[model samples]
Target: MSDDGRIATDGIAERECGEPQREPPCEFCHIAAGDEPAARLYADEQTVAFLDRQPAVTGHTLIVPRAHEGELFHLDAAATAAVFETVQTMTDALEAALEPDGFSVFYTSGPLVGTVEHAHVHLVPRFEDDSVSLALSRRRLGESDASELVSAIREYC
Candidate 1:
């Protein structure tokens, strides 16, 4: 963080006072800035929504912040809110347009981040028998273990 209140991520400062910075190498950044081609759906000053090129479902969409950030934790409050707001808007549009049974909303970050360094939220419209599956193994934790994990995470908060 700088004295003027810009948050830095991946050695770059986003949300600057004037024009926001974009990474030329990041395809999402170029798409958000209209430099690269994307099947754009919705766009605002803070965010841009578009169809995912490699979609998991028929109505798979991606919502990304206009500024470059590799992870959601690096985004400031305004950028965070903007990303989610666009997600909700896209979700509603997908529901009305595609009429899917449900949706799988997620984002990859940290060690699990994708090839594109820019942060993006995925809105995958799910159906009854679609081939896509997001099922993950489940594990039961003892009460003490769960409580300890909660406390450990809250310490950062």
Candidate 2:
């Protein structure tokens, strides 16, 4: 580990503050572990926030738990709360700095919907006419279909 508490993984050199010297198996884990570089915004014992490289908007950011949790379901309650707390702080900062019309906070839990396996909450700043849509087209469910879906969900709950 370097003076900044970042580990030099493989042959990747330790950086003072720029981009990561090497890519790790889990990008978010690497960033949180201080093994990879990111445009870090906030960090605590349990979580970290950083800018999204392929941002949906100017202030697009990701808040994640420092631990390597592949899905939101994998996080303990404290870890989940830590991640959201960072999300709240970053959202406020984004609003103050960018003056966006609105903002969005979302998470994808599984491989089917999530790009990264690491549990993360996306904080996307929105503006009028931004041409971004988080909307999914609505489809009416038949009574039987709705009942079946509800039953399936309730089983897990």
Candidate 3:
């Protein structure tokens, strides 16, 4: 409700990108819709896949659901299924084109992730030098909490 979007924070930024609450205005939609310039990798009537401008690698791509749901889990069942298909297709394209050591497909949601208002999947190619593959430090998380959380997750599922 203020300049800082989070009421309480641990150094998260208030995005001044001027996007609307539940949906970004049509510029990105247009870019996603083939009306603007983007390194489009794959597209169809219901989805679009394109390279990230601030890419982790040459073929780092994002596949966005055409309907705006704002988060991955918020997507309807069919949309979720479609996003997985798109991710697989895009990842394969990136591998064949750029040939990285491996690939990581990420779906970032919630308040701290998916900075945009639309649902999207990032197809980030993992190379040996990528800073993203850094190990999680045990010091940052308590052993008990980690074990309990993993147990809770398994139980819930």
Candidate 4:
């Protein structure tokens, strides 16, 4: 990858993205061949879970194996273990980070959902009032009940 966060450019640069600086997905396998964008949460090269750009709810994170997969358990036991381990860590963090009433975790595979064409787990946070609440590190929790949960959230963050 280039210092600019893209694969080193060749003459293949095109105006399809409406800006010369915007590289098309077709030009890179990571976005096209690999079937999706890079992750927001990455540890070494084992796995990543990033907030979905088109989220069902704010703080909705997508967890997946670093290796592109069409099925969940297609991964070797060790690799599968790694992805799930990160999923647990992320779940605890999201609960505290978003302070939602509760949260849910699910995954879709095969050609049916075809989510970005890769098998990925969805970490959707459920709130009591059904309003959008982001798990922003910048904002402090409000209300005594919510504030009390912050410590618990911090434990996992």
The number of the candidate with the highest lDDT is 1
Please rank every candidate by lDDT, starting with the best. 1, 2, 3, 4
Pitting candidate 2 against candidate 4, the one with the higher TM-score is 2
Task: Kindly give the stretch of ten consecutive residues in candidate 2 with the minimal lDDT sum.
Answer: 16-25
Q: On residues 1-157, what C-alpha lDDT tens digit does candidate 1 reach at each position?
A: 7555776566555664455554335788889989789999999999999999998878899999988788876999999999999999999999999999999999887766587888889999999989987788999999999999999999999
Scored by TM-score, the top model is 1
Model 2 lDDT tens row, 47-77? 9999999998898999988877778657889
What's the TM-score of every candidate structure? 0.83, 0.77, 0.69, 0.57
Clashing pairs counted in every model: 0, 0, 0, 0
Clashes of 3: 0
TM-score, candidate 3, is 0.69
- Compared with the true structure, all predictions reach lDDT values of 0.86, 0.84, 0.73, 0.65
lDDT of 1: 0.86
List of clashing residue pairs for candidate 1: none
List runs of model 3 lying over 4 Å from the truth.
1-27, 138-157
